[model samples]
Target: MSKGLKTLLAGAALLLVWGALAAYTAQMSLPSLGGGIAYDPLFVPQLLIGAGIVLAIILMVQGIRPLLAGIRIADEEPQKTGRILFVIVAVGLYFAAMPVLGFPLSSAVFLLVFAFALGYRKPVGLVATAILGPLVIWYVFTAGLEAPLPAWPSF
Candidate 1:
């Protein structure tokens, strides 16, 4: 019920999901172009996801420590409501728009909006993040590894 417990549970769930995904990928025979692929998708996601699961488990354990110390951020922070609201809205919009606008567009918009909202008030920083995040992400999936991103919607 508490935030720390909730965070622990969420991290546990993420670890489980990542573990399953990594196991599934392991069971599938990869093609002959064997090498690292966090940029490539060959063994990349599996590797990164597997590591993520481990890290999440670590986080889950660490999150429980504050409960041992009897400190709760959830009960005290007035800004918590606003933070949660913004995150929920942003995530909802991203998923909703992804199928409509495609990943690059949706992701770019999401980062730009979030950065701007987070008080990255300088126009240059805001513009640079808006452009750079998507460009870098696009290049990673498409050019670095030859992965395919979804096209703009209306297909």
Candidate 2:
């Protein structure tokens, strides 16, 4: 089998697993609150999973098209292992810092650092995205969804 085929198959297998997990999440029992405050805890998870599945399917189709046309996919440049590791470690630290630094602060810091790590320059855009993105999400969750996130640190 070609490397592309193998990769595609592996991705399909992962998508299958993700779909199963999403199915389980969809079946989760929602909490019943008085005054018809029906809250589906799995909404965000299911929505994200659905989006991932759709994107994966689109990518799979793109991969399969060239293969079906008998065109060899060009080998791309190898990714830097150090950069990948940095991102992994940074994400771990971001999660760990959330409770202590609060979601807004930690998210801003993480977004800034993560974008920088990915080689995004342009200070104004980076700073705006880093600051405003989390704030918008915070508002949506806290105000729109009625789900309160950790806005400020306890300490």
Candidate 3:
């Protein structure tokens, strides 16, 4: 299959999954805080799902345009299946390690290792990103969003 067709298929699948998730989240009952503290537990989830839906639609549009124009969008190069598997395993390990190592630490390690895997050889940029990326995300969650994140190892 052409890359555009694959993209369209993936987007369609994502749209279906996101639609299902939106439906499920919509069924979540809001807890009554009663003090006029207007809080919706599903707000963030709904926002994210909405964004995902938009992105899926955009992907579908982009993918279909070339096909409609009678253009064969060829893959730039053959994809490396082994690299894809490696990334999948790495992501699984990152998730498994998060509770033990904490989000910031686990994320930093994952970013560092993944950057190396992708042939990012600049020492300063690698170090900076490994250190700063998780820190920024942690701050955004913990401070900006008023959400708590695990910053230290559980053990």
The numbered model that scores best in lDDT is: 3
TM-score of 1: 0.48
Candidates by lDDT, descending order? 3, 2, 1
Position 32, candidate 1: lDDT: 55
Preferred candidate (lDDT higher): 1 or 3:
3
Task: Put down candidate 2 lDDT per residue, 44-148, tens digits, no spaces.
Answer: 777889887887787677668767878775556656789989988999999899988888999999999899879999899999999999999999999999998
The per-residue C-alpha lDDT of model 3 at residue 92 equals 98
The clash count for each model shown is 1, 0, 0
What shift in Å separates residue 132 of candidate 2 from its native position after superposition? 0.7
> Which stretch of 10 consecutive residues in model 2 shows the poorest summed lDDT?
32-41
Tens digits of lDDT, candidate 1, 48-155: 876898899997987798788897767344456787899889889888888789877788788889878766789887878777888788889988999988756645
TM-score of each: 0.48, 0.51, 0.51
Estimate the lDDT of model 1. 0.78
Q: What's model 1's lDDT at 100?
A: 84
**TM-score: which is higher, 1 or 2?**
2
Q: What is the C-alpha RMSD of each candidate to the true structure, in Å?
A: 10.5, 10.3, 9.1
